[model samples]
Target: MNLIKRLAGLLAVAASCSAVAAPLLSEGFNDVAALPADGWAFINNSSPPGSTGWFQGNPAFFAAADGPAGSYVAANFNNAAFGGAVSNWLLTPELLLVNGESLNFSLRLLGEGLLDRVEVYVSSAGASTNVGADFSLLAAFESPAGTGWLDRRLALSGLAAPASGRYAFRYVVDDTSLNGNYVGIDSVSVNAIPEPGTVALVFLGALALVAPRRLRQSRGLWLLAGGLAAGTAAAQAGPDGLMRFPHVQVVSQPAAPAAPGPGGFMAYKDPVTGQLTGPNPEQAALLTAAARAPTPLLRQTPPAPRPAHGGISLMLDERQARYAVVRKAPDGSVHESCEPAPGGLK
Candidate 1:
């Protein structure tokens, strides 16, 4: 019996070992200065009056870095000298990558003044097709507000094209304002996501550990079966179940109650009984009545208030044109004191 218990424990351990692991695809762009001649291309999309793409006339801008990590391009869009609008550049290939699964990369916009946006596109291959024109936009990322450089990440899971063959990924800068904007993209890799068949192996490994044992005659075989059963049982019991072998009972700890405290000028209490009181309501009301009551009419003048430009717009969509008002914070920061606003995107 003791031997069987040990076998069951082993089985449970095996089950846990089976699980899908996210992996890297392919990477590029460490040397933006010398872009690969064949597989890549870029073009500027700046407005007529503004500078298109980077100053050197290419869509991507190059820069020098500090380590064996070598150097890479600093993806900047804001050209202050040109009305803060820079080129909306794109990089693509002639072939369609239908089965392409993941596009993994890193971005750092090391300052508060910087704002960055990344857009991805996909399309099926066709003769005489303008690959860029036929491409369908997939994912777009906008940098969050802050001072120090931010390490940004995005997982390309649902962005795969429906058909196989020719496919491409494009990066664009949609912002046209110069606020010390600078961005760095590296380890730019694209690889296929794991096939369903590969994922099955992970599950099978886990199953082997926790499954029931067979009653085959050989003692070794029985022991192997028992270990798997035990492992399976242990996992099903959850973390607290580990104690089951020792005949221990589990107990849950209860949470403590909240303490009372004063808030704002108004006193608060349980709505059932108005036991809470702070300011004298009667006295305050009498004072207000006296002040408001009509008196020998006195002339009065009103002063003007300062102007402010603070409003939020949530533009959530593909074309990236129209915007919906998801949250309105007249005071700036989001107002969630009430029920939470629906999904936050703009």
Candidate 2:
């Protein structure tokens, strides 16, 4: 059956059975097939004025895990700008909302030099205002903290719940302008904590699904009872929690453009840290402008003439002297070009 039909069948089954809701919401990089417009905004010590961000790629660049892991949107970090102060680079993704649900999410940031910290900021969407607790993933002077695939799982339980569709995330690299480093993040997913009773029933039901057939029906009933109770209680919890129940399936996705064709001077991830080494925005712009400048060609002009003299034979054939000696008279003139003079003895 087609995917939609299969989905409908699954929904029908879910309606009949007591559903144990899944805990996560994942926004895959390729979900839109193309990168989201304004999904990411970047800044670097090297960005040219008026450019969006100095991310690498012809049209756009994307982030992905080669295998097993998933993919996500990633911005390029130009490390060259951190001439000496410190090797650092920072990037922030669009906001997220737990919408009042507690959160368990995984974040990864790996790059060259030192990745000082990956801080989570809770703020009103579009407003520069901080909402609740500002969380930190790393402390200052933390070297190799998030370097080389540091997998961090965060649980944000007590922060004020976010309203739907409005939240913020920011990553700060210590001494970014001084340090040349970049970060790669993948597979960000949110896990919503289920209520206590709902959790118990989910476990029990899950056990039965794997157990012998005889226990399955009883567990199924228990699962249904728990779901109905949870659903009923959720109605009181208002739209906040109830609405969060569905496994947020991103319905439509765009395919990522094919990997870039083979080319020269590609950036590489640092062995210690997965950070990329590349020209920053400023350097790139300077190079671009220089390449487009017009060049001027020039020709040399001959020197001016000196004054003419009385027939020192002004244009005399100098080569003639080599064959036969020619002597000039006391006057400035040559004696009508004579042959070699005889020696007095001869």
The best candidate by lDDT is 1
Every model's TM-score: 0.39, 0.36
- Residue 181 of model 2: what lDDT? 42
Give lDDT for model 1: 0.40
- The true-versus-predicted C-alpha distance at residue 303 of model 1, in Å, is 9.2
- lDDT tens per residue, model 2, 1-346: 2533443344344443323434445544443234335343332333222222323222222235432233443333333333222222332343444433433223344444443333333333542232222222211112333333433343343336443332233333323454324444555555553444444454345444544355544464445445544653343232334332334332323432222221112233456887764333233224333543579767786654542432222223533321233457688776554333233211
Q: List residue ranges in candidate 1 displaced over 4 A.
A: 1-25, 49-70, 78-81, 92-100, 110-114, 124-133, 143-180, 197-346
